[model samples]
Target: MISFSALGCTQINGAEQNAATPIATAQPDLAISGNSTPNTDSPNTDSPNTANANTASPSADPELSTAIFAGGCFWCMEQPFDQLPGVVSTTSGYTGGTVENPTYAEVSGGSTGHVEAMEVRYDPQQVSYEKLLTTFWHNIDPLDNRGQFCDQGSQYRSAIFYDTAEQQALAEASKNEIAEQLDQPIATDILPAARFYDAEDYHQDYYQTHAVRYKVYRFGCGRDQRLSDLWGAEAPSH
Candidate 1:
């Protein structure tokens, strides 16, 4: 149920002729565009390249570690972990797709099998994976399969890409806690971490660079309102 631009395959199950409604699939769709490499920018203050900043293995150093989570739009997802005390940086990217290196257009077109994701690099000593999980659950509607906010594609579905076994255990614990608290099933998946392709230059730090457009999009998309309805006081404050 994701809206797409620049393609004709709209609404996977539903047959409608419109640009906004793209077909959604539980299975990965084959991408014919072949492999395209994702651009890796050098680390900076606002956003650090996690690959350059930390361990080759995603398990993280005692000082630096990485956590990948897909919660709706990566634009909205980056700021939360970025503002955290020990968080080194957050990068918006794509994952859980069939394509080797997917572009935003390919993903948005529903051909890449990739979903919009955010990678958070943090210091383990200051902030535990548990805290990161807490932030994640509050920010997303785990029960929704249709995607997040105005976006309604499998690409935007919520997921947590855990890099290590410890992350998996903690993520499971957190999900159990949320399920008990909500007394409902949690739809978010705890999948193994995969290669995180950094999004395009313009897509990075979108909240800061495009402040007005970000706010307008956020407001229009109804992300805050939906979070409030779903989380109440538990919702994270902006």
Candidate 2:
């Protein structure tokens, strides 16, 4: 069982409410390794939902496409995609559940069936979905069935919510590849896209708004250490 101080984000943060004043940096601490080479490995045809219809904050630009992935805490999930070039915006949210507009508290309870997820709007012309998949795989522990890092519960389970058939195919291929590469069964789910509700305003960019607390909680939760242990050199910095 997870400890009181490490009961995912809420309880853990409550313990250190007075830690330090959060300082918002003008820029993210680290950037994703620029891999501009478009992934020809997967089919790139436009599907019905390929446009910005299914996700929150739909981009007016038709060129921008959205991809949703649940990789533990939405806080850690945003930074990786935010650092990438083609990504327009990353919204922390809850999805893959029956509830509508589920709150952080509800999801954190582990009964909403909604996992904390990130919705990434990016330009496919600049960064391919396959590249995003690569970054996602390297950042998460695909073999973990319970949850991610120190967070235990369905709310923190890793998942890929694909919006289109092409994405579904690519996701399946990538999952298979990763399973083979690791020689282990991956527990991350690849489900069809569901209604994604934007998390509370504060949760949008918790890492940025609560930098000090985010860092302290993240380290204390052993997120980075586990990533390094599981991913080795492939582990993402920041």
Candidate 3:
């Protein structure tokens, strides 16, 4: 396994620290609104432009389905779903909050009542919703009510933002199964999904675009280590 130096991970500079940091002051583009251009500013920061909302791709394919999940940092949440065979796309954003068009800074500050979340678009025929739920469970610490891994605060809490009654039932069932298996109370929430505001362009596909910094942050955050401890062999590969 590849291991990162503690100094390297802990010393991640600038906007690489966490999502709550205020890195941009510009207005963000609305994904559903469809009014923003691509951002090419600091590679590590969350640029206000290039938002993708709850639905990342503008695909009109009727077979595609959408699911939203909050597993602390949205960056870490993307890789797992992206690797799945049927997943069409993933968007890192804010949801289940009262604020509209919230920025990374505002949502991270915990005042917007928003939590950092990922909106997943997938094909049901290719992959089942139960499979997506399983993947979500393996990647996060369901017991951590405060947050996941090193990131804390309500903005980083783990949750399932279900859009349909079927999804709610599945999510609740999954949550109960996990709680019973672990013999512990599961802290992950199952809530109705609200309007999902796409995060800055820079935040999307972050693990791919900013590889080194992403690794450093992931290692420093102790995400994988905690996952291994929580789920053991069931843990998703990092």
Candidate 4:
């Protein structure tokens, strides 16, 4: 197991120390208007652009492909893929929402139309899309439509945003497989790829930075145990 320190904590600096800081419980007031981007002074931290520049450089492997997913709180969703062998990077962010360049504050408000999502850049040659979809299913509660686990509202909805027709077909097939495997009908939505806005820097790698609190949140929310019950032998451990 990789220690938290070894996984990189620079992404979140002062967050852990202020773990007790009360995160705003009130949802922000946001109105989803068409496909228009939201007006905000939030910094632009495009993950794909950065990944294309950093990992897609001449020296890096060229077989990798990118996939975007929204499965509730991105903090929890990011964990499984981050541990996967062939995944190059997993960036936590927002997608499928109407508000453009939304902040954590805005998205949490339940009005931004954005679901907390992760942008996964991986080597498809190494890890198949089917495997990634399998990992995604194990990490989230597909039975819940009112958001995932403890988190409620649209921001936490489960969605698989496909980047291509092949991805779309695979996503649908995977969902069907799950539906047959489980007694409950799968509730995950298959949506087309939308403009994925990378979250603010502070929201990235939140679990690694706030390890203790994240553990508490995960445990208190019963996310892992629920997944274990659902996925049985396939569930990944913390």
Strongest candidate by TM-score: 3
The stretch of ten residues in a row with the least summed lDDT in candidate 2 is 43-52
Candidate 3 or 2, higher lDDT: 3
User: What value does the lDDT take at residue 66 in candidate 3?
Assistant: 90
Clashing residue pairs, backbone N/CA/C < 3 A, model 2: none
Clashing pairs in 4: 27-109, 28-109, 38-100, 97-113
On residues 95-170, what C-alpha lDDT tens digit does candidate 3 reach at each position? 8887667777667667789888989999999998899999999999999989877777898999998878899999
lDDT of each: 0.70, 0.74, 0.75, 0.69
* Candidates sorted by TM-score, best first: 3, 2, 1, 4
The lDDT of model 1 is: 0.70
Residue-level lDDT of model 4, residues 1-238, one tens digit each, is: 2123212211233222222232222122321112222223333333222332111111145677888888887878777898888899888777877665665655666777878888899987779989999999989999998888777678888999988889999999999999999978888999988777776665567676555446555665678888999889998798
TM-score of each: 0.76, 0.79, 0.80, 0.75
What is the Cα-based TM-score of model 4? 0.75
Residue range with the least summed lDDT across 10 consecutive positions in model 4: 50-59
- Residues 1-238 of candidate 2 have per-residue lDDT tens digits of 2132532354344232221234223124432222223222322212221222244434678889889999998878888998999999998888898765565666776767989899999999999999999999988999999988887778899999898889999999999999998899999999998888776655666676666556656766788888898888888998
Model 1: residues with Cα > 4 Å off, grouped in runs: 1-56, 59-62
- Pairs in clash, predicted candidate 3: none
Comparing 2 with 4 on lDDT, the higher-scoring candidate is 2
